[model samples]
Target: MSTLAIDKRTLRQDTWWLEPMLVVLGLGAFAVYSTWAALQNGNYYAAPYLSPFYSPCLAINCEHVSVPLFGSWYNWSPAILILWIPGGFRLTCYYYRKAYYRSFFWSPPACAVRDAASGYSGETRFPFILQNIHRYFFWASLPILAFLWWDAIIAFNFGGSFGIGLGTLVLIANAALLSLYSFSCHSCRHLCGGGLNSFKTAPGRYKAWGIITKLNEKHMQIAWTSLVWVGLTDVYVRLLAHGVIQDLRFI
Candidate 1:
């Protein structure tokens, strides 16, 4: 009698697919919501609170003039121009790459699991090679982060006077979380100490490297938190702008 051998993807498995499934759900939901919000072009700004998606609003139709790079003849969402900065930053992010590659591509969805594809070229080819520009995206994101902080600072100003509101806190938290995420980036760490021959020789850079390393340790957690928080921040601003909810003043 001839026996047939059955091939298996992984032998040691304890619900390994759960994590990837959850990643898909989270990323999918955020993508859908963010795309819809960006296309609205309205309800992204309310006094003292501007959605991060619409900040640095470069469109001719923007309620708040932010550079006004586009001509009056131009018509579309201002977000399309700026969202690419943050979007690209996250798309090429180290943690995000692993998350999407596994969940979306099923490229060894979990450790010990077989990749869906038969051949593994690894990010050496055309499109994946673009991920090497993540450092450039990191640099571009700094100004956006600065603008977010500026927005958060202005959120405390109610008609040129100091004030606080729920939206103010939200914006502040959004900026803070994003700052953590950005500073904790692998590129940021490399920038701080990439070429140092010895940490003892470069004390200041060594310190900065140490600090960024600490943040990098929590990079994955901060990445997820910042991702969720930023989306919620935009939603909050949208609700305020649309008059769906009134921002409660704390002081």
Candidate 2:
């Protein structure tokens, strides 16, 4: 027995895995819930309110007529094709990438932990490199947000007059949170002219960039809240569509 070297990566081991564990739990729950909701494919629309899960309902045969913004013809799960826009944007989101890369892939789950792999090459090759398309997805996601806002706006139109309901408020919250999440994105921040050479010339972009920079500070928090709100919005619409609950109108 010659000499042995101890891997002294961490000494104080008080709940070091807590953060990663929480991330796994939170993301896992969202994944499970979203999957179930998508597969159910029922109760996604009700009168003036359409579930975020099935907006811009492109299929003519969409169960609900108020939706079908594109005259649905696909005759499949609209959410399947439609949800991917926002889904891909979030999946490639810089903040979410960091959270999942560490927790889900366990590339050194915490500051002092050792990674499962021997070396860190970064996002240089193959699948990891695909993250570069996040900016493209960001652009693609903008139009969908317009659709979501349309849904939120129409939600207030109960029989052509001003109206409010539990669903209306939920849709409003969902749209608001999603807007925050999307606009607060690092990509959005950069698009707002963050890399500008001088603010003296581009006053408009500078103003917009300044607002985005402030919002970007809380991007991670808004991301989580928006994710949760989108799901809850769909849930509320589901229950209302299924007659599991009433709309609880207040206008």
Best by lDDT: 1
Q: Each model's TM-score?
A: 0.95, 0.92
Q: What C-alpha lDDT values do all the predictions have? A: 0.91, 0.85
| TM-score attained by model 2 | 0.92
Clashing pairs in 1: none
Best by TM-score: 1
Q: What's the true lDDT of residue 133 in model 1? A: 97
Per-residue lDDT of candidate 2, residues 1-251 (tens digit) = 43345465556568888999999999999999987887776678888889888776776677754355554446567677688888899899999999998898888788777887888877998788989899888898888788888888888998879998888888888888988988999998888988888989999999999999999999999999999889888888888888989899898
Report residue 31 deviation for candidate 2 (angstroms): 1.0
Give lDDT tens digits, candidate 1, residues 1-251.
34334357777659999999999999999999999998998889899888999888887788776777888876788898899999999999999999999999999899988899998877999899899999999999999988899999999999889999999999999999999999999999999985688998889999999999999999989999999999999989888888999999999
The total number of steric clashes, by the backbone 3 Å criterion, in model 2 comes to 5
Evaluated at residue 201, the lDDT of candidate 2 is 96
